[model samples]
Target chain A: MMGLRLILEQVSHAYRDLSVLDGITLTAAPGEVLVLVGPSGCGKSTLLGIMGGMLAATGGTVSVTGEVAADCLNPLTYVFQDFALLPWRSVAGNIDLVLRARLPKAERQARIAEVLALTNLTEFAGAWPRQLSGGMRQRVGIARALAVRPACLLMDEPLSALDAQTRDLLLDEFAAIIARAGTTTVYVTHNLKEAVRLGHQIVVLSRRPGRIRATVRIDRALTDRTARDPDLLVIGEELWRMIRDDAAAAERERVDAPA
Target chain B: MPRLEGPVHFRAAGFAPKDRAWASAATLLGLLAMWQASASFGLIKSLFLPPPVAIATALWHLTVSGELWKHLSASLMRLFVGWTLGTVFGVGMGLAVGLWSALRSPGMAIVAALFPIPKIALVPLFIIWFGIGEGSKIATLAFGVFFPTVIATAGGVDNVARGLIRMGQSFGLSTGAIVRGIILPGALPAILSGFRVTTSIAIVLLVAAEMIGAERGIGAFVLSAGNLYDTDNLLAGIVVLSVLGLIVAWIIGRLERALLSWR
Candidate 1:
């Protein structure tokens, strides 16, 4: 799939009087997976939203590279933390939700089937979200996004809602499916292991009123993401150190503040 | 590897109707027994409290003579037409107010201002406008049903998750598509529940409207029976009204089951 590269420049934002993000810049290369890791309230999600064009950065420009086809269903799509599957819709129906406008009836069915197979959700296509476990529901959420054939995917803690075991089990599947889809993605998470597992470029930000702390590039192939490489762990640890101090400071500040 | 587990369903079995029937039947039988004993022992005057047997016999004659059906049919027809009208317009207007920002406040203001006023108090106004025929009765029921439905429907729409709507917009879905795919179904549980309230309101309004200047409704029969002091027929009319309410509630229960199987 043709992917889009995103570029952010000196982005800063605030909610009325409360500041959230400071001047910061980053580039997500085409077909690259960029993960944003930071403490809670670091504005990683705000940055992701800006990149997805869902939020307008107050002071800077977020742009994309490469020509977008006029017929693209969505150049940017999001997979939410809550799965956000329409409970009334079946798995296949949920996937078809995004494809209904992009393709005709027969072609839409084919696309849903293809996404279901990719996400390993083919067997439960008729199942309602209420009938699926948390992990499978999130898979359906991913499948719905994939059916849009988005050039860029923006995810906000997609697996954080799952239990640790489910997150661990689905990590490999996610890496493989996303690898196959080949969409440029900016994933926001606080989990360092997940950041290292999926991101080709890990961009770390500091606490509230977040600013860039560090950026690390991993040269490992997507296939290698399936196994826990020592180098990846080292990079994960380095990334952790970058934010640990800021996270502790943020926590202390929260505690010391008036309730 | 993924766990390969079957889909986990949130299926819960509701109480069987058969299990519920016996308890209700017992309570009814015990009440009937007490009334029969009171009447037979003359603890209360027959004119004041006719036994269940007398009421049942009156109901039997009304049924055989088809007098009960005439009033029942008229009342049911008004309830059906009025509630259906109210629900249709209520859902449509609710969606309008819910989706379009321009209409939200004015519509809500109109609803809030009008909803609390006693609907029965407007039957005289409705009669003047729509006439003393079935139109006024239906209009009264419709008016009573409309306000609560609008509140419930708009509330349901407002409660639909903003995240899902944003997701739809991100997927390039048009407004209409988002409403159909996300909004309406999301609001359905609330909308269906609103019907429960609206139907009961409609029945009350129907009876009230029928009591005034009408000759063929259960309300009229009850009023006339009361004037003549035919306590048995008066009680029979009350019993018919109770049965009508039960039937309406039962129909609504069935509708909820059919429409909300997804939940």
Candidate 2:
């Protein structure tokens, strides 16, 4: 799974007059996970969107500056927060939805089979999205993204919607999958634990009209990092400290602001 | 509070309702039996309200004489042709309105303007335009079915999740593929339920158009029977229409089940 290097140059966005993101410059090195963490309403998801070319930055440019693999169907693919699965489609069918346009019948079927196996969803290939638990549904979402064999994966809080136990369970699975694929990933989440678990480099942003606050790098291999590690815990604590006051301020602002 | 002791009452019980097919059949059968008893006892005049047995006898004669098939065939043809035409054009226009910014406002404006003008009231005008032939009858049904379909289909398309569409776009699905695979299936439940309303509307208009002009439909048969004061035949014709409604509803039920098994 060869990956692309994503470069963002002073990217900023505003929804009409209300500015959201400001001069957010970052680079996701090839085959690495770059996690964006911030308080709510910080436009981390919007930044990810711009990086994926799903949304154009209002002020600056985002570009991919590396070779895409020959088998890559989508150079930039997203695994959305809400799962964004087609309810009418079966687990295998949902993955096939993206492959149908690019591959022929036999290859599409084989690709579906491969991704289903990758996500451990092969047994439930015929199951509909609505029939699966939230965790399982998001697994299917990841599998669908993987089926395209993307050059880069843009994941937007893909585990945030699950119950805490499911979130923990799937977090490990996600780390394993991402490491195996080695796709350049720009993952956005509010959970520092997830950021610590998956990210090679973590970027923290201040509250709304988000600006980069801190960048933390973990040299530890993704597979070697564990929740109980003293260094990882310290890094997590430092990140919490960085955003704690801003998170509080953002919360109070929301509660007191006029609708 | 002693940990709020004693068994917790089943407070969440009984909001869900279950369907009983036997109960429905029994209800209809019970009503018919009572009606037959009333007629047998001379409590009601048969001339005013024919007994179920008399109506069944009339139906049996109509069947034997092959009169029922002729009327049934004509009505079925008009219903099929009119409904297919309306659904095809309505869905096409609906997709156009739902997908493109250029067509949305103008299409909705035209729909809103024409939709509320009750289609039954336009039968006379249609007859003048299309002539007092199959053209006018079919046109009446087709027109009656069109507007509601447009509204249902457009609403369906509108309600498809924006996130799903964006997901398709992010995956680089072609515009045509997105519309066919994502948008169509997403909107189908609404479109199918719309079919329920449009089909009934088509039937209603079918009868109205036939009553006004056609010489060989169930509506015409019922009208002529009423003119001759033949209560049994009139009731028989009404029975056929009711049965037709039930059959159409049943077919749609099967279609919904087949298409929406995922739900």
Q: Return the top candidate by DockQ.
A: 2
- Candidate 2 achieves a global lDDT of 0.92
Give the chain A TM-score for each candidate. 0.95, 0.98
What DockQ number belongs to candidate 2? 0.86
User: For all candidates, what are the clash counts?
Assistant: 0, 0
TM-score of every candidate = 0.93, 0.97
Per-residue lDDT tens digits of candidate 1, residues A108-164? 888888888888889999998899999999999998888878888899999999999
lDDT of 1 by residue, B159-229 (tens): 99998998888787999899999999999999989988898888778878989999999999988999999
Cα error, candidate 2, residue B75 (Å): 0.6
Per-residue lDDT value at B261 in model 2: 94
Tens-place lDDT per residue, model 2, B104-214, is 999999999998888878988998999999998898888878888888999999999999999999999999999998999999999999999998898888888889988
